[model samples]
Target: MKPFKACSCRDPETKKLLGKQCPNISKKGHGGWYARYEAPKSADGKRRQPRIGPFDTERECKAELARVLGTAAQPKAHDERKTTFGEYLERRYAWRRSEAETGEGLKKSTLDAEREAIDLYGKPGLGHIKVVDLTDEHFRELYAAMRKLNRPDEKDDRSEILRRLKEARATRDGRRLHSRPISEGRIRRVHAVLHGALTDAVKLSKIRPDNPTDGVWRSKGGKRKQGRAKPLLWTSERVEAWEKTGTVPAKVMVWTSEQTGAFLDFAEATEERLYPAFHLDAYYGPRRGELVGAEEKDLSLERKRLHILQAQSDDELDDTKTEAGYRQIPLDDESVRVLRAWHKQKLRERLQWGETYRDAGRVFCYEDGSALKAEYLSSRFRILLDRYANIRAKAAEGWPADRIARKFRTTEAAVAAALQRPLPPIRFHDLRHGAATMLLAAGVPIKFVSEILGHASVAFTMDVYAVVADEMAEDATRRIAAFIPRQNRLSAVGASTVPSGG
Candidate 1:
């Protein structure tokens, strides 16, 4: 490859490139220099010769040539530079697959989530941009666009949604009139996936000099402004708002102690088959995966201990999500009693199944002793909540208890014993939040709560439940004030009226 001058100077009649053959080729301003070279082999093992540019002087062309040559010389660097972000993600790279698939890396679920994020937001927004040319601004723009992205309605078909999006793009006002906007938290997760991929590219392949994502703040004002949503207690005002609008204030909402008790009472009265599981979840806050993954040997009713050594994701049982998740949790007396009763019931079930029982040995299982899926547990919880909610609503309307139970396929006795107060809707995972809140409210040490919940750090546990901690602080002050005998003490607002006994 070499750098040389060329021109458009051509024969008047022929109208073809003259190169050095033109009459005006010797003129100072006749032509510019060009850097010409054969590019490195592509991923398919093919190389192509190319002309890059025409410069006023040979020096500029030579400089360009040097840079191109240098990049091409580095192993795989030229290919990466030519590769778009979308192409890189789609390629069968070693770093992209799960450990199970390749004997080394991310879990299949985690990888699937990453690919989904990339396809949904990353590919549409910046996938066409070359990995080598990616800048912080590109990522910032993508995140900004994602923050404004609206969630499609359940009834909105894909093609209709696409048409609306296309129309929005063509309109003067680009706002998407859809359902609620996608949460900033979810966008941040998408950011995390892209950022991780870029980081891996830089470290493992040297595809880019540095990760552009590193320069982009997760949100406009940083993490403090994009704070995590703490689990808010379903206070009366929030509950009232939810009942009227069918909307909860925050993503994470916890039931109060009274509400938790009401739910447990309802579940027990209904003779819910999974009452023991619900009790354990509400009391200990094990993740849904952990709850469904619990083996029969993991529970020690006599010792009041439940070991969370593994967790289920879909139907696959594996190690817990994190190292801290493998810790043993102390069970309360009530939880122990519930499990003991459940164990006896399971014994009777085993006898009934006899030789044909699936014998999954799970703490919670189907009637045939097959393992219960995490999703099934969540679905069942929702059904229970719906029935409980409906029955309670009818009871408030002066309907007979037996009639209400019959309508919802629950027991007449259960309906009769149901608490009049409404049980606010919450995700099954919120039971975990409620457990943490109850522990914090009951004055359990934050460290203990962290351990019980299998949080990686006490600091994180404190940060998540900081609101609960603040309330606890206020309660402490009130209790201390009431405990102290301060009749002659100075008032809080002003000095004491009575003279001090000097």
Candidate 2:
């Protein structure tokens, strides 16, 4: 029998073979083995090539054609200079992220609004304009479109596609509407990010002349400014609640922070049996990578010290966050106990996994005998929080469910949000303050507290946790308790005697 073969099909129109049309192919082989595609041209005659692939059989030809019909597509290379402003913004936006992981050029998150502005206004208004020809007016149109993320009328999802078809959109951060019709504050963050990217691009001379984001502060109506960032420092009530419940996922984090003694100052913590790993972070603030990177071999048991011997990311091993992240942290007897436990747990896991595991010489591992990603743990922490709070605080705090669904990797969004929770009216770091208060009440010297908390100077230690309102209230009660006058003092010409300071 002959090898299987199929004949070509032809279009009824003028009997031209359907396969030979220049719908977009750059070149087609005479032997029927290959086809090269050029970009499609807009009405203005500027063309861009987006899709290119090689098929082993004709069965794939129709499938490739179907993919091109559906919406949501990237601009072809040929349309590089003629695509919408939104196209440029999206491309640059992705570029920055890819660069950041590699430790390459300027990296940031300010492209969100720039991207939205382009999607919302810039591309419609001036995307067709040559990249070399962008100007202040184009920026204004882009800004105008971005304003919609905040505004309701501008938010009509139905007109989303139509509204984006302008050659007059612009983006700006202050009170001005990005594209008018936009009216909300929740989206200001995206705008802020976008503007930052445009500004940096301007500095790099990637885009010509001035940046459209110049002078733009993330704001709405030049007034309703974006909220300030605040750290989500755990509080005593919250901590005590966790200790009592002992079921919250964040409990480990809180316990770990307190137990680390790297930062905790509660006198009871000095009981000498508990590990105080928290002090290490309180003093050093090791990024998750640096902290999780610690391993058994990195410790000197006799000296009671932990060293940052190795660190890594999905990409490759790196020195700590900076040269300074590489340091030897002295441990106390208590801290040693905790670390030793964690070390034993890890060693057991490694041995169980044996040669089947992806080895990274890490100190932190999962109960499953595998390396635990820091991000995954963060997610678990949130879950444990939700369950512990009976789902009350989670909803009240407005965490993203979709986000929490994934494991904790140290994403900027998670980190920023984790750091953005509101602080108490007094010292926001009251957990630290409470710890210090406990330490001071037990007569731990200010100098020792300073060393444990990792403050380079003693004055800082004294200034922060020494003046608690509750402590003052206690002192008031003690001072008001006065005894009967001293008989000897009366003989000395005093009817009543009190301490000189009193």
Candidate 3:
């Protein structure tokens, strides 16, 4: 293709064409110079002319003409159907949803998370860019934008702050309200969604063969350096601090052994219907979802084993988080007893409700037999812990009988008796961590802990519970030293110097 030419309008008064012959054009100065080019035909084979600019000089117009011609000469293969990144993401999500419905793709929870990431980060940051035009620089810009969103500056806009405050008041319960920065883990999840979408685009030939995200730097050099915070054990010091400040360290907080026992005891005493579920979680480290998803048919009371074939997400039972999460977990005698008691309790409820009872076959359920919502259980667990804390505080202060009784909704005698003990508060999922730590501390093999926890691999288990493992290693060192008798060591050294039997 030849470079397009530039021309300028004539002087209005003179009414003469200001072509190359104009005296002003020789001086390289002109007014209203415009570049015109014969543009490429449309896909429908219609001819068209495209104009670029109204530069004051012929040289400037010519440069613009050259750039436009160059761009037109190398048309994008998929330019016929230009798709924005946002549009592609929507299409990709629909395809994924279709595959999930057909049992060929992501789990509902996984898909929901991806959709959230796309809407919150992907669409807002890089959505307008064409998939074929996405570059490493664009991804870098996207990451920078995401980091800004992660820890957005306190909203300076009064209207926005008022809106958020209104929302807070609407949802406010006794729970404290605070803004939390989007964690590194959440940013990584968003990146994963973007990477997955780009990968799919490449496979479908919607974009270039290479995925731009493949080479993009993660928010903090990948999740290994800035991933989810590890679960923190509720040691005595942490418990004391928490009791004083009411601030729990790390979201995933594990209870100490004493606290775990105290929670189990309190749950049982309070007639919590899901005590058995909590019991299993504390002893076996099954996820909250797995505990809620437990079915009576999958339990072998005689064998003391529970099959973790699935997990509860929202109100629906679905496949376990991974294939490895489908393994069987052995139950202790106490766990078996608790489950047996819960089973008998369930049967009696079923009998009482009779025809009205909804038999979902879940090992844990409401008295009416409907499936338990995972969110309800989590919230209820927190509420129960709060109640337990209040009761303990009242008892500690030596409150009079009637006040304690009225506060706890129990007899004064019961309140007085319960005052002798107190339990530290912890999140429900922390029960799983407590179980893993207890097992590891008690000299259970890491492999067994891994299998019991349904972790994908022992390495993952080790990584998560490395603190406990280090403690166990120190204990082992001391025990080994104790086992090697001083006399025996001395005898061996003397024997070595004395020479062989020959």
Candidate 4:
């Protein structure tokens, strides 16, 4: 390692840096002193020469070089100084992927989201900084910068995204990437991932002496923060408003019992192959990943149970997100009947296809026995909703049966027979929410509902479905009032009704 003097002067013709060739390099204030040292070998065994510098004085540069040389005995200490945050993040994700093969790491869906957090936010903001250079102030500034950003949109053009962020940062006025500002909750989650990574750097890898994020305050102030939005049911009023405005009442919405039944009935009437999967979701509340990844062997008709052993994320099979997610859900008689019929249909199709069939042992699949994609559930659900909405509109308009059939390009009988019950729009995941709401409405214990939905805990389930719980409580109050034999119920307790001592 050696300390050297360098200047920012560049060659006029070549447009290259003139390091030691500058005429004024010997002058005291003409150039800055720099330190050059060989870094530890990379994973591929390649040596890297990292230059540290631009110190105003030669003494300072030599001191930095001496410090760097003293740490040569410990390669990790050198790494801590040279490794950028982005580099470490990439390594961590790679490690996680390797560990996942042993069934003890994050699923693809989780890793993808985390990678986005790192790339979209982390890289642009703090990625270039060395791990050792990170501080509470750095993180605080990062949080402030994140709060100023608009929500990212995959569909937005790259130039548009750049312009959006730049304008948002410069003038605090710009077209949004989506409908609203990036939520504080999202920032908090980003902070959490970063904090975890830094903590690992300090404790697990021993790359850093301490985590800089430890001293960083996550939020600005106050005890209040936006929690997860509870699912709201699609009541008649809400449905009307949605039809008029094309917006949901909440981020998460559930269907009323009538709406849920209408959707399922319409699906079955149309001979949708995934009807059984939809039924399972509506009644049992398994996630979309779980529904598609379900194996035929995991179902037990005699035992009336379905085991959630794994899930498909990004079209790849992986373990469930949590231990609670890997559970055995009891099936109702109706579910069993639906599964039996579905099994028979699948068998018939398999026999027809013969050697061409692709049997992956999935309980729900295409006619050729190919596995269903996780996203198909959501997209197909949307298609079904639109079809159902169109049919209902035609029926409501009192169009002649033949005209309505011709409009839909289907038989007049099929068009006329379509159920007209309103199927208010809800996400496929909302089918899971509707299932939980139905369970709560049916007076099933909250604990049982939690287990059915594969929630981490009853409290979490209750917290998420608190709206449904409140509605159920109100209904219970009304039912109890009606059930009790009250003779001329008083609007308020009379003074005479109170005890004499009171």
Candidate 5:
């Protein structure tokens, strides 16, 4: 080919481009596939050293060029194997994606996420680095890079950054791109992916003694500042206001959230064809979807118990949140009243529209007496928020449905928005927390609260319930005040009479 230079022209299609030199490559962005060149770009009259790549960053560009030119500069620690991080990732990605044709663990959502992560952080930050070279230090670097690459602006999150992270982590890009810090959950995922890949590399004799990620990280929740870990909740006054008017969406949402305990409870409580949905959730706490998908007869009124047999989730009507989510709960008085009212109401609806009601026979139904969908309930919750804009205005507050949607989780948001704005606002899920705190204040056991929240371990419940437990300590002094000994009995408790061990 004619000597390549700033102005020298070649068929854009014919000239092979490497890394940043590709016309299609984004300057600060990433795009479709391009291969590494086997030789450096020719520098016209200058007798020169190798030109790594057209990349802006010399480190990554030069390293990639070393891989293309010869085996001489391969990984110093594992040079005999002759591999680089980027090359390994490319290969692994191809293999995992190829599994889709064979119908393996291929999922559209996952693939889409991986593609987005690559586009933002690129394969270099994730898959291309050497396995043996990876260290906890490297993970910190990767996480920092990832953080730099995206904005935590609520809008950016809505744009799918988290989804992409999920996909990227599942695949080889499992390493953190920036050490700027990430959630423990995100870091854990990266460690898992790294360990898996490195373990395989070791088994295949591609590396030495161990998977470097081993014991480097212990899994935990996200450390990133995504507001807070706790869910939000509304206040009682706001809830009562909405209940009185039956017009404001915020008030309606507030009532449902507090009354139900969680969003799932609201969904259950409001289920039409599946009447008495809340009976199951309020007492046992199945998800809104689980309640929505339940049959009219799923719960046994005569048995005075509800069965959490299965759950309809974000995916399918598969297994519930876990085995813990599938248990029987005896109805409390309130649960019984609500369930009976709903059942009786549903029976009247059925009489009014027999054939229509028989269609799904879902206990949770719409005005038409047809089974209700989770999305419909979610929408109704929103409608309630909009209808009460005046009430929200009067309270110097407003709903945040759009804001909630960006989080990829919203029932919690609705419940939170329903709360009247306090001195410092409270999140909807905070209602559940408030309930737990109240229970703790009331001397209820941690194990009981944990079971209500559907936590698998009591220790986990206690750890999360720590703050509420402290509230109980405050009451300790108050409770002990009643037992303070009488003044007459205190005369014998003089300091001189008490033996001093010291």
Candidate 6:
């Protein structure tokens, strides 16, 4: 390492020499101190003198020179291995965010999800582990820690409910009032994020060539598993239990054909502006974001065709979730009629709002013509379901259907039909599931359903809705059996010919 030296210049005010015989000082530029050193040789076998900086004083320059030389003296493997997992994750997030902003990277929604996973699971669990030291075991431990981290405990204070109550009293803003345990799906997401970051690290040569997260176990052995739970259809028994206990089975639930029709009848009869959107989801299986992101120009009501070009991702409108998501769907006569009615309704609302209306060109919008938010749509759908349930309960108690219909501003027929079958509690996304199930039940080809649903492949569709496929198989067997005759006419014809028996 080079020794410290001061610049050889006289102080302007004092008119005196700044230093005496400073050998390491450079007379170039502004006569500031600098350090000269030898860098590692290339494959051709030649040395080069690398210069440091125009530091204020020789002491500062010398300190920097020492650090540079010390780093060079270490093995090449250790030179690029200084960053920890936490630090690399932050850098990776920044890079990904920049890519998303420039429109050449991951979608904003994807980046946000990655950021969340890093903050919630990555940083808290494996932040301190150095990139060089990261191993499959580290990721395994991280999964275990995340699983145990936010588990609800009996002794924990349920302060969120109290906070929500206070907020309700002070202001009528409704937010979630409680927390739930971190799901296996979320943990798997974190694992995916970590795996991606470390894979990049390997490519950048910041860590070992092999990725540590490649085959890490997400759960303990022997039946403990990690992945998204398959969606469960709400049966009659489940609906009854839900009515009594106010609890629904499975995070993702699908309604039967009758229940779906009931919901649609209620929405349409009540003149819900979003009825068209919900109807499209049930019949065509477009994602919630896609339905909200739809625009007037993308629809061809006369031709009975609708184009899906984009989807809402948080506050930004972005490309579809996957390349396959950008597709054209053939609309049935009913879908076209509903869409045309909705278009006319939107025009009326726009005229009422006049110059104050914000025409963002979205098919679904608020009364003010502003774009509809996905979360708002979901929340409103839940409210409508609750109202539907109440109306059904009243109808069960012998309340006059016409009176109930008048009270709710819907038709008496709609009320009667909605009460005919028990409504299954389902989320907004479940409408997509119901659509797929209905199509499969009707014997639509799985490939066609995959395309309509914008799934990457038919195998994926079959995997997700395996239960539906099983039921379809049984139906196919029964239909085949119905075509076969127990008595053979061919045998009787052959028996009449005596030569045939010989």
Q: lDDT scores for all predictions?
A: 0.77, 0.46, 0.72, 0.78, 0.49, 0.75
Off by over 4 Å in 5: 1-141, 152-191, 203-297, 344-392, 395-449, 466-502
Determine which window of 10 residues in candidate 5 has minimal summed lDDT: 249-258
List, residue by residue over 1-502, the lDDT tens digit for candidate 2: 1111222445567776555353433344322323334545666887544443345455564454443332113333233334444555667767776776677743232334344545545456455665534555555554555554445655464343335543234345434334445444434544555555456544542443346556654355567653432222244455466556654333112222232232233211222211223344444344455555666578776898778755655334455544444567677676667667666766676688778756655555554544555565445333423332332244357766434323332233332333323222222132344445555545667777655444557776566555542353344345455444455755676535545767
Ranking by TM-score: 1, 3, 4, 6, 5, 2
Per lDDT, the best of the predicted structures is 4
Estimate the TM-score for candidate 4: 0.72
Count clashing residue pairs in model 1. Answer: 0
lDDT of 4 at 456: 92
Point out where model 3 deviates above 4 Å. 1-81, 124-152, 157-179, 208-224, 244-251, 410-422, 469-502
| Candidate 1 RMSD to the real structure | 7.3
Poorly placed runs, candidate 4 (over 4 Å)? 1-75, 119-121, 135-189, 215-224, 396-398, 409-419, 469-502
Residue 156 miss distance in model 2 (angstroms): 4.3
lDDT of 6 by residue, 1-502 (tens): 4643455576677777766344434554445666777766654777656666668776788776765664454334344556788898999899888887788998888888898777656765677777766778777755655454335542353443322222322323543222455566676777889999988876764355568788774454435674555777666567889878989888878776667888888877766668888899999989989988998899899888889999999987999999999999999999988888888898899899999999988988999999999998898788778778778878878899888888777777667667777786788888898899878877789999999999999999888887954654554566578778858777887788767546
| Cα lDDT of model 4 by residue, 1-502, tens digit | 6788899999999999999889889987898989888777777898877788999988898977776665454568776677898888888878988887677887777788788778766766777888766778878877766655554442353443343344433423543434456677878778888998898887777676668888575455645666777888676677888878888778888876666777787778666768888988998789998999999899999999999999988878888878999899999899999999998898899899999999988987778998889988898888877877888787778887678767866555445446555667778998898899888888889999998888999989888886775674565566578789876556345655877975
Whichever of 2 and 6 has more lDDT, that candidate is: 6
Model 2 CA lDDT for position 80: 37
Model 6 scores what on Cα lDDT?
0.75
Error at 438, model 6, angstroms: 1.5
As for lDDT, the candidate ahead, 2 or 3, is 3
Q: Is candidate 1 or candidate 6 better by TM-score?
A: 1
Model 2 lDDT-worst window of ten: 266-275
lDDT per residue as tens, model 3, 301-382:
9999899999998777889988899898988888888878888898899999999999888888889998888877788788
Clash pairs (backbone) in predicted model 6: none
